[model samples]
Target chain A: MTTPRNALVPGGAADQGPASTTPSGDSRRLIYGHPSLLAERPTHYCPGCGHGIIHRLIAELLDELHLGPTTIGVASVGCSVFAYDYLGIDFVESPHGRAPAVATGVRRTRPDAFVFTYQGDGDLAAIGTAEIIHAAARGERISVVFVNNGIYGMTGGQMAPTTLLGQHTTSSPEGRDSSLAGYPIPITEMLALLPGVSYAARGSIADPSQIGKTKVMLRRAFEDQLGGGRTSIVEILSTCPVGWGMTPQESMDHVANEVVGVYPLGVLVDRRAAAAKGA
Target chain B: MTAVAERPRLMKGNEAMADAAIEAGCDAYFGYPITPQAELLERMARRMPELGRVFVQAESEVGAINMALGAAATGAKVLVSTSSPGMSLMAEAMSYMAGSELPIVLINVMRGGPGLGSIGPSQSDYFQATKGHGHGDYRVPVLAPSSISEAVALVADSFELAARYRTPVILLADGIQGQAMEPVMPTFRMPDWDTASWELTGADGREPRVVKSLHLRPEDLEVHNAHLQAKFATITEREVRWAGEQLEDAEVVVVAYGTAARVARTAIERARADGLHVGLFRPITLWPFPSKALAELAPRLRAIVVVELSAGQMVEDVRLAVERVPVFFHGRTGGMVPTPSEVVDRLRVAWALTAPTP
Candidate 1:
């Protein structure tokens, strides 16, 4: 299964160091651009948020994979709710938590289409819990770009199912105690346990190097959908500057120092070996 | 087109609908059997494969409509038939298809509802059919046919509407209408498809296109919604359909739709026997609802009684249309269908009180 791959940023080797990879001198700082399939606009996420970076990574992958023609994005109600506007791909606004269900319908019907869903912690873990789990269990051929931003971002940061212990949010103003909140649910771990899932990975955009790697994994998820295999989810650890009541830079520091410890990033499931076996 | 030259035969409304769907080149039929309309699925299960179509007996109504959407995205003519509760299950998938602008047909042999309601014929989903059947700022073209023959014609029309509008189209009738037999002379035939405009024929002949409803920018979203609204506005102008009977010098006009409209028409004719001046307003397209025609009739009539199987749903439209013309309502919820005589009696009682013996 050979495809024509066209890299958007020439491997990102030039993107090195602490000040953060700024796309290069006079090359336009807007990470995701016109040629990248995303609609150019100020994202609806908080300052220093990972959603923007994640969107850029996905956009860059869409360009590289040549999935623009077949790309279909299912938008759910969350911080990534306005993803459709940015991705500029064909989109379907799914009901709260039903993005997976909607994505399944699109994938099953348009099997040739590269179908992916953009969802948040609450939208996936709570309201749309059944749809995502069932879709994964059924091994529906679709990709989900799940953002576990710890706290719900849209309606002022509330304690999400993915919110870590002692993390403070609007709903959990007094730090989230594990006993009262009953522990943060690691969605990737839960989903990976199911045989239906093909890939499950968590990544944060706080660091420049990790963001580059996140794009590679995101591309892999979309490839799984396009190749007509099993379900995949790339859970993104996003940031909340306004919700956390800090300047954008401070929030990035918070994700690097505080949030990273609780939600350690890694691949929970990988079916690449099985994919190789099948081939 | 007439290779079969098939002789006209008496058939159940639901079965005629299924046959018409097959004749319209429907590529797939997905459904789970339910009371009153189960025979329709029986007919499809027998004939679909022979016609080179996919007929799947889905695990549930949820699965059935989802399958229909899957088949429809490829621009395959698809139909899913169900009763009331099954329709409620269908609502979620229906909204998704509508949002994504996928064309598919839904044949709703309506029963009573709220819950487990009734399997018997009821025009109770008028509100749901006209409204909540699809979520968001979108409209489903709901077509109502009274007789088996109309079901044949309406099913074909629904597929056409679904294609033309790029939205879900409901061949919305009830159990009574679904099971009734009537004379059907196949007038209009299914047109050979032209997928040049819209249809996911895939990346074979041209560049691959993705149909989705994700709008991230507020301005872009506003533009998309406006574009959809414009299409709807065009729908209202070109798609509105209804028929009026004996309105000239009549004392009352009975505004009804679907199975209830059929019953109301019979009652209107019966009342004429007793020399009561009565007319009928029957809506064929319940969504762009024959409002203009009804509004025009409002000035001349004494009053309007919205006869339905549900609790006065379409009556709200009548009230809006006839503002100060005095609107009266008669309905029975949960599977109750008023007979011709019952309707005549209601009309007589209303006639006596409204304009008196003239």
Candidate 2:
């Protein structure tokens, strides 16, 4: 796709142009903000942070699925607690690690509404381990968007549950030692073992093509829930440039290189598709 | 006048409260199984699905309370019940629910406990319930019901009070009340308020709604605290309720609440039959404490006797309310309940001590 000439214009001016005949005798179309984004102001994320890309993809999916009117999102603690502010949908902020439990309530009460939770690695893999495990075990028809940056970005680059072995974080200055810190938890794989979970996938946002793949995984997760499948989870390997003490380009390189080796990408489980194939 | 129900049926206090929650059109119930209160959860599990409402036996008390908080944020009439130790586990989420100002109803079927003391009845959580059970400068309107019928009525009223103030309300009962069966006329009605105006449905064509309790800035937190305080003041003024019996000509009055109040009532009657001028003042709303009414009656009474199932937890409040009048406490704890005769004996001693020298 060719980039628009006025792409850098603020407030998405390039996408606000009217349909007109191009010099090549083709009709031109403009694309503005995603229907579900409240892009009235800039985000609070650091420069080169992966949250912006992830948030945009979620907004686009909400628009594509037309779930804005009936979707209830649960925002977990950490960097994404303010997701409700940027996403043009109703939300309830859960305490650290409680988003799964909260989403369980919302989904159970409003079965007709699409419910999802946006959580970071620390929020889901640490304090909230029980909540997510039980919610999945109960087969709650909710989608979970897990962003694994391998560090506690909001709390200033501390080690997270998904921190890679030998990774240098503020809390693990000498790099994480398996003997002391144990190994990084592969939560998606663990959840996939549960019969209640209908779909589980891990993707990366390190490159444009990878980001596109991540969006596809998220869309499939949401579709599974919409089709009355049990719990669906899409764990996207993200980046935290400031927290990782690296440039944006270097951080993406790290996710593509280091994180991908420790936490492999691809669909861990897809019960519906597997069943169809079996039949 | 509201129309009366066709016929009263016999029900346990726990089941009566659960039935009342359904009649009041509760949208969801999330709770764990705990002794004395397990029947409430059992009833909800069976009935909520039948009525097309939601019910979940949460993995833990913490999960249950948080789930209720989440449902409440969506403007659903939510309820969660637990016993002493279970209530302790739910305190953190309860504080968050209060801070968020989301309306919810919590039923605590009192059991003996400093730490799982006993499954038997005790009022040890009086201080915890009335004096900011969780952590904060906030208060929950607590209604203590003495009988099964009153439990049903209070449970029904709790939903309305919660919605009216957008705050948590507690329907406090004891193990005795939870286990004992009595005749109750369950009345069903929808709440007389609009929940959609504040509840989170969806953004749709309007601004999105965010329900949260985190006030990071000091200034913003101060404002939130002030707003909560104002709401509490209004509730205290408008919602104080109690049953004052035979106080018109009594010289000695017994102040009690919940199951203890039933014993106090019998004690007062026994004293009255013996030609003793004793009355009973039973508080229904514990947080408001019926301070004004107690103070007004303090000047005329010679002594105020506080009867309780704990070691005099509520006597402190009685002392604060009736400064000049002498206050005496007679109680039991550790799953033990004081007999009516014991309360009458304490009343006599209090009366004798306060008698004027002639």
Candidate 3:
């Protein structure tokens, strides 16, 4: 449970190594440890889990947007249920699948405050489907970060609503039969169809380049909410190595190949661009 | 009392509660339409947006309650209204709110139940309201208003009590009380309480606050339950409220609440006119039960008669309070409410059975 090496420290990179005197002999130099917006504690997520990366991206965006002091995050039930413990911002924990509705409340009540919901695949597509759809349909001015790992990570690789047709989960050890388990739902595509959704995009963190792309999508989603856009959401294809019974590298390779093939990555909808083009 | 301009207006019980909530400075209202309580949501839809407050006709009762819970976490005053079935759907979130110790007001305009029984008036929810509606060793302060005026007052008071105790408060009215019209002064007064210390309003350079009910450790959960129990005990001690009419020298006391209390009052009046020693004891706070007051008044009366719309749900509480005094129950279930004449006849029979030999 050691802290991530990339955790941001107060000073810059120079503070971590031996102090280098810049002729004038100024002592203190900035270095890295953890982001200012992220808490200085080790997360309980397993090795190779994408949650840490997602958390870092969110914290980075929050810091970049200068929204740390004015942001309220709603945490959904799942592995990331303790996202509040990792983010140094105000948060409210909602019951399974209710984070979107909760975020709606916060967004409507405090329009000036940046509100967002951090949700997982099962939490967003199953029990909470109605909440997310209604929130989008209402054009609620809140940002949502949906992490799709294709399985219930915290609950030990159980079948999730977004689990692939032939995916093997604890509940579907026989390799999910379509007649029994049904097909994987494309929640991002469905949400993008709602007129109330100003932006809906899908990205992945399977590799360095994908992670960078996902971060851009995340920043854009947050910016959309800040710009008074309604119901912006970013669906990130995440990896759950422990749940998938694979090494962290193997999970990353799987996400890059199989997962990306199944769930294509890119901007599914961009209402602002569409509106400008129409005008 | 602080002086304010009084504007009397005739309004239904549901609308009165909505008006009172808005007048009390409720910042948001999230609700799903349900019979007997739809007017409350309608009123909110009409008024909340005009006042620049938040109003959402949620997709479901479950969504509405959770929305209110979310708003409450942000230190915003919130209200959610529903009927029996809707309340049942919201029970999960209500329990979560109580466990989290989030202050929010929930108005349950009860109707016949046990399962979508009917849309008519019924107090079957008395047990559900006074006892914990959701799982856990927590109790939300339940207020029963017998009249439209009391409904308005109690709806306003619900917010104050909820904020003071940091707990959910239920304004348990009935279909009749919700649908019936009565004149009331549309007075508004914001609660004199501050939530800045705990409410999750952006942390703002301070320590981040989390509004949640997740205690992983057994020992920690036990401690949390103990702390909640202490708060509930204080509320039980300080917030038990009721009304006693003509109980000084009464031979029999009629106990009731909500719409049934009004019927009992009429019954008491008719019995008194007939030269009978009958009085009415109406509980304003169903949860705290006003049991102590009833216990104090028990020894003076020969017997106690409990009148309710349900099949004697609250009679058990009455009996629990007045153990020595013989308690009798007269109830009409499945949407049938007993009239004054029927109640008076029942009271006469009860008086004969328990009154001293003469």
Best by lDDT: 3
Ranked candidates, highest TM-score first? 3, 2, 1
Order of quality (DockQ) = 3, 2, 1
Instruction: Tell me the tens digit of each residue's lDDT in model 1 across B1-358.
Output: 5334456676777777888888888877878889777988999999987876677776567767766765665667778899988998889878777777888889889988879888888887878888767567888899988677777778778888888888888888888877778766654358455445555433343433455566657899888889888988999999999877888868788888777877888898889988988998888999988888888878777778789888888888777766667788889888889788878888877787777455
DockQ for every model, please.
0.16, 0.67, 0.79
RMSD of each: 6.1, 3.4, 2.7
For every candidate, what is the interface RMSD in angstroms?
Answer: 4.5, 1.1, 0.7
DockQ-better candidate, 2 vs 3: 3
Top model number, TM-score: 3
What is the per-residue lDDT of model 3 for residues B1-358, given as tens digits with 9 covering 90 to 100? 2224467788888888998888888999999999989999999999999999999999999899999989999889999999999998888888889998899999999999779899899999998998878888889999998888788778778989999999999999999988999887666566755688888889786888898998888999999999999999999999999999998779899999988989998899999998889999999999889999999999888889999999989999998898788888899987788899889998998888986776
Poorest stretch of ten by lDDT in candidate 1 chain B: B200-209
Clashing pairs in 2: none
CAPRI class of candidate 1: incorrect
DockQ: which is higher, 1 or 3? 3
TM-score per candidate: 0.78, 0.94, 0.95
The local lDDT score (0 to 100) that residue B93 gets in candidate 2 is 79
**How do the residues A104-132 of candidate 2 rate in per-residue lDDT, one tens digit apiece?**
88887777888999999999999899899
TM-scores, chain B, all models: 0.93, 0.98, 0.97
Scoring only the A-chain of each prediction against the true A-chain gives TM-scores of 0.84, 0.91, 0.91
| Candidate 2 displacement at residue B83 in angstroms | 0.9
Best by DockQ: 3
